[model samples]
Target: MKQAFDHLKAKGKPDCTTLTDHLDHVVAATVKAATAFGMNVDVARQGAILHDIGKAHPVFQHRLKDSYKHSPTDEPMRHELASLLFLPVFDKSLWPVMVEMVVAHHKSTRNDTKRKGIIDLDERFGPRAFALHSAEWGSWSPTALAILSAYGIQARPISLTEAREAYDYAFDYCKNTPDGYSEWKGLLMAGDHFASALVHRTYNQTRRLFNVPLLTYYNRQHPLYPLSYIAADSERPHTLVTACTGAGKTDYLLRRCRGRVFYTLPFQASINSMYERLKHDMGKDNPDLDIRVLHAASRLTVEKNKYEEKTIQGHMGSAVKVLTPHQLASVVFGTRGYEATLMDLRGCDVILDEIHTYTNVTRSIVLKIVEMLKLIGCRIHIGTATMSSVLTNRIRALLGPDTVHEVALTDEQLDQFDRHGVHKISSYDDAQERIAQAVADGQKVLVVANRVETAQQRFQALQIAHPNVPMLLLHSRFKRGERGRLEQQLTGKRLDATGRPIYEFNTGQGACIVVSTQVVEVSLDISFDLMITDTAPLDALIQRFGRVNRKRTPETIGKVKPVFVIAPPETEGEAKPYELAVLEASFNALPDGDVLRERNVQALIDQVFPDVDNILIDKDAIYVNGRWRIEKLVHKPKSVLFDALDIDSMVCVTEADQQAYEQAGYEERMAYEIPVRYHAIAHNGLARSEGGNKPFIVPDKAYDPVLGLQMSLALPAFYNSFF
Candidate 1:
């Protein structure tokens, strides 16, 4: 095997040596990792050895040597084509696995690009080079022939004409039906990459096998010991847990789950961090069990492997899954293609963190979906630091009253527990000034806003306000590569090529500012000296507060940090009934004497939101009645309602709009159109006004690619112009 690798390496340029060496190392490492994870040792070994054999093709060879530059018309590397040619010569039973792996090697794990005519084989492998090489291989020296024969394979020849014809057919197909090809290609690539890794293990010796017994036996103590009994004993199908931030909810939920497990959250940023945590935790108990992360940004590979594929499936079958709500939503509602794996969600134990983040309309939609999930016997646990009685009641009504439970700490108890560790600032301006001063003093600061545009504006404002201070902006709108680079620079310990720390602000070694949206909440390990944020519902505020002064500094008195909350926006005109009720309930719930303290905040949350039963019984009828009336008055299609609410409803727009939307990437903005009662009143007056079109007009530029335009404010003009 080494000699074969060496032969291929010699034919390539000096730079190619490093690439080959790196490939060898990766193959070897994969084998070791798989073996340690309890995969079949022989399969793991063989899969690694042959995984990269396709890279030896002349096309890839040239690219690795930098002798070829890619262009729109240039032929690309066809690793799958090379793999397919080599695989048939081996045992045919391994064909299925090899074929999938070969095709997936260069593709995404979801098989985003594997259609026959979508990819140009000639462009990829250099027009008929495979056929030309066949004749050339027959004339190779005996030493080379021996190496090929050792793998029980023979070299095949291909004609340039065949390659050219195949390339033309594929390219034409792609151009004519780009959508179909694009989708197919994604799936094919994913499958091929997974298969190649399995193949590489065939010739490597370092594969590791997982030992289930050892993993299961290693029990790390968790902090939520007292609640375990309650969770296990409750007959409820779901639990609404409201523990303080930093509580080991992950471990608690993992231990309480029955069969398959899924940990879900709203944001991709939080999902990424949770993925790492779950991998580490589950790796302890079931090393061989497939622990997968699923999301738009996830790295799950989909290549084929008779052994590893089954193993992967089996692991997923009874293992743990961590993903964002988007992945789950896609499985449940997506129509463009079938996600056979979604069937796996059935009977799985699901933990939904930060349930409070969903708005009213969204909450209604998600609840209905959860109700359906309940019918299928899925167990759900809702975890958050702040949950209103209304929200809890709504959750129970969807699942079952008996199935909902709460883990709440009273205001006094929480205050006593942490000793008012989190400080609340009264205004944004004061918070901003303090943050600036902190940066000037070389302290790290994190400024969080509720929306993406708000975060950008605040970041730019900070930059202008403190020209010398280094500031970094992060949000979901930026590309993944950009986000990753910024995160690394902000948090990484390593210096850049210039021999200076990657992130430098006015504070020298410690000073830097990260302006972000809600992405900063939960699971991130980075600490900030101070935080300035817009006021959200109390739970969100608490979650944001958890990000500040999280870890103990050498000079700090305790592990807690000061948190300042920007005052809530002032409301005008007739307030929404729910908002008024919430405020009144909060005011009444305040502790007898104190009006502005942590204790009062907790009390207010408890009084207004309370437990599940109070919320459902008290608010459900009103909410349902209001929703029905609004639906009728708007005369909007049910599909439009679902789309506006950002729920999993099948809604299709006209082809013209759809095409334009796709070209402009406006599908993301569709979520904003979902009507929330408060948003409607505050922005559009649609919730309260019944007569004619108001003077609302949504600016074309204001449309978000993800969350549609905030049309509430323009409702009057919109009605006047279109209705």
Candidate 2:
């Protein structure tokens, strides 16, 4: 039998990677990954070298050839089981973990269709041993010895009887142990996945801790604010900060971080804006902070900044990750790649900012995430401008009352920062005289709607009535590129020849109006002189109010800015996203006058969000039951299938934009795409699947540059034919 070096994986061609080379690379990677988190390194090495030993079988060699691509090979020919054959040679103490790390690497512990655990020795190993030996698949004897030698384990050969006995012992050990007993299982999975992604194994550089002390660095940047000073003095591992908007909450939260940071927000737009702001703010003074943005389109985010040529994979490592809560939900739900996420998050600091923004099912999921982060030893820091007493009590209960440190603006400080006055209005159209006067006087006016459709309608009406005013439409429905440009314009930063930020000076001196949806509620740092918005949940309304008169200055303190709150829409479905009951409660709870105090705002939030239990499903109970099912000796069935928010959306592009999508790179293509809800377009019958199960393709006529997506628009026949 010819035996030198052989690989189990050939991909689109013949096998070429030598077994020894693959083992060496993976062992090095596994050690690095495991040791980084203070996990067992020798066990990682043993699992890594033996992981692909099954590839030494002759049938697997045939399976790797092009001709056998569609042909079924003899026996089940499962290599993961083949790797387990060497269980007899290892010390019994290491048997359970090694078997679990090797056998359960690719597939879960159970068989779905048959309703049985599939890691049985008789079913996988007994019938295949003779064929493996006869076919000269390295003769089992030499294969085991070679792998053992490579791993530097001194063990004797085993008879078939000995192998069978070893399998039974190993199997029993794994069956009794829980999946999360130790992080070695996750470590093996992470190392294998990371090594496979690269053409050659290279040490992944993790983000470094801030060179200067956290408090010192932040205090120097903002000499006027003592938020960082307060944070440094706080003794608890968990922190809850109740501060006014634009009160340096972000810096305070970061100051509390002692290790790697995972900063979360509620919306994608908000997270994207925060990611850019942090990357600049943190790096301007110290360029070594490996700050990364983690999201669906995170690769494009890094590319946009020109930080490096490649995308930052989560497993590769980052000092700081700015993401939405959904990214953390992946861990609680046990979704794919969660193993890596769990490893990265272990002992890290996670900042859950704007905790009140998520609602219904998403809110429950976020609460669950907090519990899991606590369980995994993450130092949790929560910052919010609005959170009810009931919710705060629940959070303290979840992570022991004594463990949490509470900080807030003094009564005097809240009074000094109080900015907006609310006015109840029947309709924005009826208040046009006021809006017109604001625009005529060269004031920035922001109009916010709960739904995208309403935002479009408002934008059209405003544009038609005040054609001379500089107006911009901003919402989630616009193509990503269009939305990004609009956001940049709103923030007033445009790049110049030297790639430095220069103000878009043209929009500086005009009476500007920006019409948008709930996207502007958080993280977008722009101050408007006036705001008119539809009624929403109390917490959401507070976020919206914060946008007007956002930046507090010495001259602006105690001055009341006008915010007109239009009554709720007639139909419950018309409000779409937010619950009708909550909106109604919020409208009735509006203080009589426009001016609101921070303390009263907290009371309004408490009155609206009366009890934390009823905000969504009983999060504590749901999470406890879900956690019981998820955290087991062996992973329970379908454990990783959790959805934080159930918004049924699909990425869509018009027929006219299809060419641009195909020609552009991933980030560029994202600009031409739009996300539409499944229910909105399902009945129209104009949508057809874009192959590869990608988002459906629609007709060009359905989209308008200014109006955004209109599902009511009928599809043209010629465009329909292409699909």
Candidate 3:
């Protein structure tokens, strides 16, 4: 057993890579990941170091190797099983979490699949297998004990049962929840993994340690301690910030946070972009600092020989991190093993981006998030361009005015941009016709839509209307490789080796029409001559506009181009209330037909949208000061907005593509999976099939495993039967 350990150590196994080298990497990663969640460095580092000491056992080494092959049900050797042996050698209290790290490291608690294993392996080995051969191998725990004792470290062990219970409770909670819960669970697990790694690295390195500093940057100067200002402020607990889209909200919050900072974006795509930009900025300032981007789809490009493994291992000690809101949301709402990640959020600064994008149940969920963070002493910074008074007030009530800060661009500031003569069109047909004509006239055109189906349909229509014109479509739903290829073609980049642009639309680029969904709203550096989009709420529309005529050239006047809105359905009867409120506010605020004229849009937003504070204000007011002032507005469920919009049931395509759609798992996802309020065209077919109402099944022999049957982003207009 000792020889195996020696051999593995010689091979530089991560668990045995010269204690110092391993400890340093772990410490750096823990501190960095923890900082993002606002955790205490000293505690986080200690947890990181001691989390995996039991891995020193030969039995654990053998088990890890063996378990890699068989199903988990096959009585796999667990590191936590060896933690009991450490009680006598080291402090018993510390053993609880050490055991936890071992048990929870490989698979999450939600996994229920059992392995088909030999019964003898389970009966004879049981959980005490770690100490069975300990005596023959000189007892691995004693060696760990002697080392700690020599250093005069006073530690205590926590019962294995208690640790197991905690792990079980967290696991159950995450499994029963939504996919969003997975993000929170992942964050918690990452924190635990990072913490364990950090403690080990720090102890092994023997390097000087320092508390993370909270520094502020303003116009490139480090001045006016932001943390100190935060500590001194006695104003409202929360401040409403109405900054412009590009304002440095991240920089402001990071400066104020002492322990760690969590910056969250609404979408994974946006998070990826922010991660790259933040890493680049931090790398320029602190070359030696470890920076990481954490998301299921995150990719880090570095200048190392073995970049892939190094990037993965390096995250065990990053100093800065960029992650998606889905990651953070999962930690708080997830069922299983989320406590560790929640622990990271306990002492951090949180930045919630694009808060206005949250809708209905998500709004309720986010409220719980803010409340949870506050309970754990988190300082939150909410940043958005089109924030409603409701959101601002709700956040303020939870976080308090003293902890919040507001930085908004005034009406005058908004006016400067409006003067550029950018027209905001409200008719879909007018917008579509204008863009189609532009493409036909041998000009490049960019059209943005709110949804994937919408974008695809518009692009196809443009192509059919003008057969001589070239058209391309892009969206988040496309496979990554396919999207990359299309993006390159649109940008006029390198053609393939066969002298063909990755896409047929770019035939050496005479003129092309590129239609996209919200994916192109921000972060892609490319610009277009013109853009027409479906009418999204204001902030998103403004973002879409930024994609067009981006460069402020001398020809940038009418060259500024027109932005046409695909008008929403006209509301009627009972469904009219919410839509009427929005329209009334828009008209009242901008009565003179000047939609892009001033900051009046913000006022319109406030009047139409209910303040977050007003969500349950009447109920709360009844409990305060013994005064009941009846507020006489008709109340409706938040879900009504979504239902009224009928986003879920609106199938943009026809039944002719049923077979192609079913193969794509569109029916399953729309029916039983995704909880969003939108409708899919495949739902009816799936229902009919379940009821045995369909004709004979026709097997598709030409189905390619790699490509499958591709769904056209450009659906036929015959599919648009929503009206």
- The digit string of per-residue lDDT tens for model 1 on 1-723 reads 545545454224433443245344544544444433334445443444444555555555555554556677654445544434444334556544444333433432221333221243434455454453333333332333343455444534434444344334323433333111121222222222333334344233122222122223223453333333333445655767666654545555555566567777776566666665566656655556555556443432222233443223222233566666544443233222212223345566778877666555445445644664575468887787666667666777777677675566555434432412443445566676678678778787888886665676677688788887667786654433334445445454336678676545322476777788777776565667777776555555566766665553234423344555554444622222225444344334433222234445545676566653222321221123213211100111233333544444211222123333334322132311222223333543332211122112233333333223333223444332322
TM-score of 1: 0.50
Model 1 segments more than 4 A misplaced: 1-219, 222-238, 284-289, 299-318, 330-342, 401-413, 416-427, 464-468, 489-509, 552-560, 569-602, 606-644, 647-723
On lDDT, the candidate that comes out on top is: 2
| Residue 83 Cα positional deviation in candidate 2, in Å, after optimal superposition | 2.6
Instruction: Return the lDDT, model 3, position 174.
Output: 27
**Relative to the true structure, how large is the alpha-carbon lDDT of every model?**
0.47, 0.70, 0.46
- The full ranking of all candidates by TM-score, starting with the best, is 2, 3, 1
Q: In model 2, what are the clashing residue pairs, if there are any?
A: 177-633, 178-633, 179-633, 334-640, 421-594, 421-595, 422-594
Clashes of each: 83, 7, 60
Q: What range of 10 consecutive residues in model 3 has the weakest lDDT sum? A: 628-637
Best of the candidates, TM-score: 2
